[model samples]
Target: MAVNKLVYYIIPLIVLGLIAWWQFGFGGLFENLKGGVKGVIEMAPNVSIGAEEELATEPTIPREHEEAINNLVETIEKMVTSPKKNCFLNYKLLGKNYGTNSGMPSLGEGGTTISFQLKGDKTEMLIAGGAGGKQEVTRLRKEIAGFKPCVIAGSNEITKNFFNRYLGQGQILGDNYKPVSIINIFYDTDGDNGNAIRVPEFGNEPVNDEGDNFEDEGWLFKAEDGSICFFPTNKVMSADDDGLVYGNINQINTKVGVVGSGLDYCYTWTE
Candidate 1:
């Protein structure tokens, strides 16, 4: 009875969300979600989060587990922000060596995968490829949607490989290798979840690359647009031509579970 009622309620909402996306826009879906509703756009009808995204005023993670989550977030932040600066300059940007740091969950694969379990005394540490030995590979990417964990990644060749190889595996790429163009963000379950967006804006470059500038633009930070909005997690129906992504998945975090009954939104670029 409860299951039937649940299904009866969710189906129309999903359809309505899609129709809304088609008619109104991405903003419309969010508006609906904020209005105490949940829905998916035309891409997939598998999403079902409650007031989690909007009303998750407190951290759903157990108080004891808070430390582990903090450690994981801090590590991720370090990797995303400073992983490249320490590497040799030549290979930083072009090399597939600089990207997300340790403590990433294995999406699914042989060596690089981690079993989802309680983060006990281990403190949720994911070593970089070189430091961790083997780069954890995100195999079975097709299983992302079916699996509840929203820890997935997408990008171009160089960006993808670096994120997996170095950050996930701790292995640095060859010399002069380009670092990753990163846009990773974790929605804060505690408070101010709204401000937790990773790459805010992606747009055209106003200034052209001249010889005088010591800081040249590399693929790591370069993009077709100024901001990367609701990424792979964002609904396909709402994504504009520049916001679609279809890269192979890169897994992060071993503590697998839904992001607190909230949609783990991501954007993938498409040709």
Candidate 2:
């Protein structure tokens, strides 16, 4: 019995030693384990951070500019809240960039009119004209509902390209291009005055030979009676129109329905 037990124990010990030697032979098993660990580490997500990360940030409007916009908003609120008669805000007229003979067929003018009217419970903004004297853009008030004049600051690629093309090489348009100041103001107490809106900075300057005078950022606000208005920096001058935008009245008005209603509250230059 004792001999049989010793044989059994010796056989088990020899089997255990052979298994250990096979597992650790020439360090190959350990190398395989190390490679598996390395692969797992390589598959892990990276958590390191640096300055190369990209972020989206909105440009900031200056404090004074903010104040100006607030004041303008307040003025608009007052005008729209209490309806008036024989009131209009006029802006220089504009036409399409289409070749000659591309405006009103009868008057040879392309204009727009933007009106603020009280409809039901909400104030409605209505536009009534477009290229060729047709109301092609806006047919319903909701298309332009809640459309209030706003100010936009900050230099962008479009602004840069415009300046580069007009200001010429080495003439850089800085990031500080702000359109905050009031260009003109009209009060509708009188019914005979036609407002002349000067483009705050660029309007007063005559256009150059390269068809770049004052760059109009386009219509800041267009109305339904074929009237249009510009942002303070935008101007209306064309090489084809003899430098005068004719038949274009930048009119912002209540629906007095009068042909020549004067401005009740016109824009006045702040700075």
Candidate 3:
């Protein structure tokens, strides 16, 4: 009975010793078999550990950028709750270097049109001239994703201030004056077919340059090609004969695949 019991215990150890020798090496086989199969397993590395966690995570937006958006949100909220029941705001995207042409008022094809009409507490926005339009400002924020600070590409000042550059001056829309309508007329003037305002690639996150990022100082379009430029107006509405808000292309960061530096011009009240 003792001999049989010894053989049974020895058989498993012998098999384990052979496996260890074949898989690893004959050098540690004896030492490994001292603690049975458990020792060999513990010695073996766990190759599955790499898959336990994700290789990368999404980038986080800076806190200052977040604050900028909040400020703009506050401005929009006030507009929605304005006393004017027939409030209307239209946002248009024009080319980067618009109005720089010397002779005659250069006209180009309009691109990316967004309109908003106040409804009680919140304003309903229409994006891209689609049939299924009319979403609230809150929904627009979700689509914008987030904002990043403006950074010049291939430069040391990656975190430089965004509003330091020169952007042309314009009168802020006064509270006493409310916007009725803003219309942009485009003419193919030269017939070269090149004057049309280039439309930004909507629904895709903007691929900024190495130093490129964003700021929340401007009005965030639902799909403004992932950029944040200046808000066209101070008050919710504008009643000026020439209510035009031009986006400073130089002020915005470089976009990888989009034309112009930032958003185009938003024209209002010129039929």
Q: In lDDT terms, which candidate is top?
A: 2
Better of 1 and 3 by TM-score: 3
Q: Candidate 2 deviates by what RMSD?
A: 22.6
Instruction: Put down candidate 3 lDDT per residue, 1-271, tens digits, no spaces.
Output: 9999999999999997778789868657656555564444345523123332221221232332233334444444433333332122222222222243211122222222233333433334332211122222222332221321111111112111222222333342222111211111122233233212211221121111101111112332221122222222111112111111123332332331234433332222331
Tell me the spans in candidate 1 whose CA falls farther than 4 Å from its real position: 1-69, 73-157, 160-197, 203-271
RMSD of each: 22.6, 22.6, 19.9
Candidate 2 vs. true structure, TM-score: 0.24
Q: Candidate 1 on 60-121: residue-level lDDT in tens?
A: 22222233334433332333333233221111122222122212212111112222211322
1-271 per-residue lDDT for model 2 (tens digits): 9999999999999897678569887487568766676555446523222321111111232332233333334444433333342133322223333231111111112233333443333444443333333342232333223333322212243234323332223444433123322232211112222222222333423211112212222223322221222332223431121122221222222322344342233333231
Model 3 stretches astray by more than 4 angstroms: 1-58, 85-271
How much RMSD separates candidate 3 from the native structure?
A: 19.9
Off by over 4 Å in 2: 1-58, 85-145, 148-262, 266-271
How many backbone clashes does every candidate have?
45, 26, 10
